[model samples]
Target chain A: MKATVHVTLKPGVLDPQGQTIQRASEAIGFARIADVRQGKFFEVELSDDGDLEAARAELERFARDVLANPVIEDYRVEFLSDLPAASEQE
Target chain B: MKATVHVTLKPGVLDPQGQTIQRASEAIGFARIADVRQGKFFEVELSDDGDLEAARAELERFARDVLANPVIEDYRVEFLSDLPAASEQE
Candidate 1:
């Protein structure tokens, strides 16, 4: 099984990187860019025996435990289908 | 409505940041870490009239056009419900 984890700042929290992106967007003429928050993405491959729910729980734990500061950040989990190329090797 | 965009390097493509994170992970005692790929996450607010599919398409275009280099990266899009506090304003 494979999964992706996305981590971002919770709303109402200040994000300096997001503000920089917004300013850059305006400078580039994309005036419609209302807001921007920056975060991290992780792709993880797990044992085949793991199901999506299990993967999600594990990934969430990883996020809160190591990947993010839970007090200020939020995360999303996604389970991905192993591509044929990836499956062929295992 | 709100959405998040996750941009990641496709498999087989090199990710230096991921390697750095992996080293950090191992330094912290996570020996089980198999692979790591780093990417970016974005939080965006869209007009309520927008549907998920529409939001996804727009986000994909944005990713390909600016957020990522399509040659070596792939992106996933997620649609999120506007928080009650955000909705209460309008």
Candidate 2:
């Protein structure tokens, strides 16, 4: 089984990397962009034994403890299969 | 309007950061983890003028040209509202 974790800065936190990206975007002629916030993504492949509930719990623990800094960031975990492909635009 | 860009390494690329994360996970007792891949996530906020299609097109350009390195990485852009909250787990 595969899962993904998204770690993002808390809303009030400052993001210098994101500011750099925003400036780069403007420099590249994308003037409409107002802001950019950056974060971390992790894709984990797990040894599947069909116990999805256990996998979910383990993933949550991993996300909360290792993948994200709780004081400055918020994280969310999901099964990879649950996400729609990038090609599927709305 | 808000959109997110997910930037990830191509399958054959060397990901030392991911390896380090994997090692860390192992060190922390996550024995079930088989592999870990790391990537970048960007949340972009755009000035809304009520044109969704145009925003999508602009975001695609920004993602392709500025947010990601096409040679070693792959990227996807999505409207933030379209993503289900992380709490909506399966």
Candidate 3:
């Protein structure tokens, strides 16, 4: 099993990186872009057991313990058989 | 009309941030994590016109000119109507 963890700042939290990127987007003529929020994606391959729930739980624990600061950040875990696809979900 | 641009190091490019994260994963007992690649996911809200193709093309240009170093970074663009979902696609 493979897992992907996306770590991002929780809503209402101040995000300086996001603000900077938004400014850069405007500078580059993406004036229609009103906001930008940047996140980190980690792709990890784990020993496969065909159990998504267990994998999700373990990955969530990993996020809490090491990957993100719970006070300001939130994370989502996804199971992938191989590499993740190149699109963001709707 | 929102667009997402994921920026990652091109294959074979050395990623110091990824290396550091991999080291940290091992230190945290994710010994099964043989490697790690860290990528940036930018979620941008764009003015919607119900046209995905043009939005994607514009985003690709943004990636080339401002969002990433095209020589070392590879990027993919996705269109969304609202904020992106939590799980990564597989």
Candidate 4:
């Protein structure tokens, strides 16, 4: 199975990178843009035999312990379809 | 409208950050993880009156021209529902 994780800064936290993107858009005449927030995205591939519930729990632990800084960022994990990942054979 | 953009490295591209994450997971006992790829995520808010089709086109252009490096990265844009962005009132 495959899953995606997104780690985004909390609303009140400062994000210079996000501001940079917002400014860049304005510089290029994208006046319609009100805001641009940037974050980290991850795609994780799991073994076919991995226990679904265990993997889910472990993945959440991984996300909190390593993938995200809980003090400043929030994370969400979304499971993808069960299709074999293209990179599995590599 | 709110939309999301994901910028990921194309297959065969070297991803040092992804490697770092993968290694970290292994070191931390996440044996279920077969591989991990890290990418960039963004949340973009457009003005309410913004043209839908035009915004879609502009967003794609913005993603390609500003958010992603076409030579090694691929980007996908997904529009969210029409709910007003929280930051819009700020």
Alpha-carbon deviation at A48 in model 3, angstroms: 4.6
The alpha-carbon RMSD values of the candidates against the true structure, listed in the order shown, are 8.2, 8.0, 7.2, 7.1
How would the candidate models be sorted by TM-score, starting from the highest?
Answer: 4, 2, 3, 1
Better of 1 and 2 by lDDT: 2
- Candidate 1, which segments miss by more than 4 Å at Cα? A47-58, A78-90, B47-61, B77-90
* Interface C-alpha root-mean-square deviation, candidates in order: 3.1, 0.9, 1.9, 1.0
Look at candidate 1 and give me any clashing residue pairs: none
Candidate 1 vs candidate 3: the DockQ winner is 3
lDDT of 4 by residue, B1-90 (tens): 889999999999988888888887888798888889999999998776745776777788889999999999999998897434533543
**TM-score per model for chain B alone?**
0.69, 0.82, 0.76, 0.83
| Per-candidate clashes, comma-separated | 0, 0, 1, 0
Best by TM-score: 4
Count backbone clashes in candidate 1. Answer: 0
Q: Is the docking of candidate 2 incorrect, acceptable, medium or high quality?
A: medium
Per-residue CA lDDT of model 1 for A1-90, tens digit only, reads: 667777878878899987887677667754445677788878765555434444455556766777778899887776687445434545
Q: In model 2, how large is the Cα lDDT of residue B10?
A: 96
On DockQ, the candidate that comes out on top is 4
Q: Give per-residue CA lDDT, model 3, range A6-60, as digits (tens).
A: 8888989988888898787888687666778888877666654655445556666
Report the C-alpha lDDT of model 4 over A1-90, residue by residue, as the tens digit.
789999999999988988898888899888777789999999998776745677777778888888999999999987887434433633
Worst 10 residues of 4 chain B by lDDT: B81-90
Q: Which ten residues in a row have the lowest lDDT in candidate 2 chain A?
A: A81-90
The lDDT ranking, best first, is 2, 4, 3, 1
| Tens digit per residue, CA lDDT, model 2, B29-73 | 987777999999999999776666667778899998888999999
DockQ computed for model 3 against the true two-chain complex using alpha carbons: 0.51
